[model samples]
Target: MWFSRGLGSLNGVITIDGLVKRRGKTEILSGVGFQALPGRVTGFLGPNGAGKSSTLRILLGLDRAQQGTALVNGVPFVSLADPVRTVGAVLDGSGAHRSRTGRAHLRWVARSAGLPLSRIDEVLELVGLADAGSKRVGRYSLGMGRRLALATALLGDPPVLVLDEPLNGLDPEGIRFIRTFLRERAESGRTVLLSSHLMGELAETVDDVVVIDRGRIVAQGTLAEVTGAHRSLEEAFFALVSR
Candidate 1:
């Protein structure tokens, strides 16, 4: 939300090595390893129960693994002196209370993150929510809620963005705006890890693809390499994970 200079050199590239996690008696992740390099948008792809959310949680330090480590810029995320300034994440919900106005929600986050109050107005405008700043999130459409979520993520202007299903509920214009925004962030040498089920979208947006199934990585490479003989990413995804 604080619109200073854009994040300059982002060292927050994600690295997960030999990550293993188990819930109850079931193994959720089996030595998963991947790298999301800076200056690129890395697409994390998998079917339901494929361990994507588990891995993301570990990376964000919201959950711990029974074995192995997940790092951001070579340091575990929890170890970052200023985690907010290092990485901004977007998930399913806007993370805003339903009764809170869009601006109220951002103000709360700003105060919690030690960001200046000025950022409330700046980020509201940045995500095209300036006109609706006073509107309660409950009354906002799905698309508007998503815009608010994104605005919150940008509040710290963090160099690394880890977004899951970011395209949810977006109109054509919203989708286009997000595409361009993410591309520009990556081009500016930031790290972006995007997890979405929209294969066609990822095919157009991501520089690299990582596919996991049944708690293990099945394939990972550039679009061309992973797709191989398939005509599209969706085809290749079905082929790789089905087995």
Candidate 2:
């Protein structure tokens, strides 16, 4: 697939250790830690208000942690010589300007990152946005916007992908596409770390699971291991957070 091209020998290994974050008086993360290994889709699952976002922010170096470390490929995100080629992150909705066309938005990002403009078309096609590439961002539906955001992330062709609530705005078909795409990514030796509260979708997509609740990690293991004796991952998740 075009997405797997140029991946080369790079490895995507995300390691979070003893991360602690506080917002004034409230503790956001308490000794949170986990690993997202290459060749696997690791679902960072947690309910709303859980420390998932905070942990991801710290991992991407967008936010500071009071203590501990989050490393990508054994080095801090900021320390990477070519971050764009190492990690692709989609934290929010397409960070695109409403006035610009989808293609234009990607052109701007590509130029800024010193990447080839040709890559824009490839990503747009990969995300099923080739026809909408000329449309203004304001004209896009929520799912289209999410796809655009994913396209932007793929522009870097990074070895690792970190996505937050990626399935939120997608329809069933879109969800299925993403699930298959991420699985293919992992199968092709990339690391995928996604944070989401959609239990059913996650149960189908992830190879490994990491569950966090109330600022602490409650479970981390393979899909079967984390799910344990529960009827499903959703049940196990509820049981863990309810404790």
Candidate 3:
């Protein structure tokens, strides 16, 4: 288990406490909290309109929280001087320019991060995009685009990775490949947090889970602990959120 920081002993794990989010008068998330540990897959789950994406945006510092805190290594993501080296994230793949080759897009990102060009090919191969690296990103399929986004995430090989709906629009083979890839990353002593609407997929890929509903975390623990002998994770999940 990863220990907390000195003195305060606040867990080095990714943590959010009393997290509240709002847009004008609309509240999106309220009292959201969870911890993501290194070397494990923490599945972030919620139904549509349940604030999963909002929470991920806050974690990436793309959206600031109106209340509470989102921290990695006990520091807010925006406060970090070098976010790329500390955390790797793939919030959306549409950020890439349509006319750019996959390799060129990655090259620019790597250059900005002061990462070596070799790391670009390394991540491309890891994401099974080695053959398509020279192809224009707009010509690629949705799954291929997602893979490119993932490759961008791995460019830094950071200790923490946060992916949102990573398996969406993926083929069966793509889904399986990404599941294995994420598991391997966590096994190598990295933190892996994935948000997915597919609870069944989360069952197969995650070690722990955090369930959100109406912008709140309703359940969190090991898959087994949360399931508690239930026939499936879906069953346990529904039981919690439906409660």
lDDT of 1 by residue, 1-243 (tens): 322334333265688999999999999999999999888999999987798888998998989999998988678989887777778888887778999899999988888889999988998898999999999999999999999989988998897899988887899999889988999999987889988767887688888999989899999998789989999999999988875
Candidate 2 lDDT tens digits, 82-144: 787778888878889999999999998898789999999999999999999999999999999
Best by lDDT: 2
Candidate 2 residue 59 Cα shift, in angstroms, is: 1.1
Residues 73-130 of candidate 3 have per-residue lDDT tens digits of 8889887666667788887664588899999999999998898899988989998999
| Per-model TM-score on C-alpha atoms | 0.92, 0.94, 0.92
| Count of steric clashes across candidates, in order | 1, 0, 0
Cα distance off (Å), candidate 3, residue 66 = 0.9
The CA-based lDDT of model 2 is what? 0.91
Model 2: lDDT of residue 193: 98
Rank by lDDT, descending?
2, 1, 3
Better of 2 and 3 by TM-score: 2
Candidates sorted by TM-score, best first: 2, 3, 1
Worst 10 residues of 1 by lDDT: 1-10
Lowest-scoring 10 consecutive residues by lDDT in candidate 3? 1-10
What does the lDDT read for residue 153 in candidate 3? 86
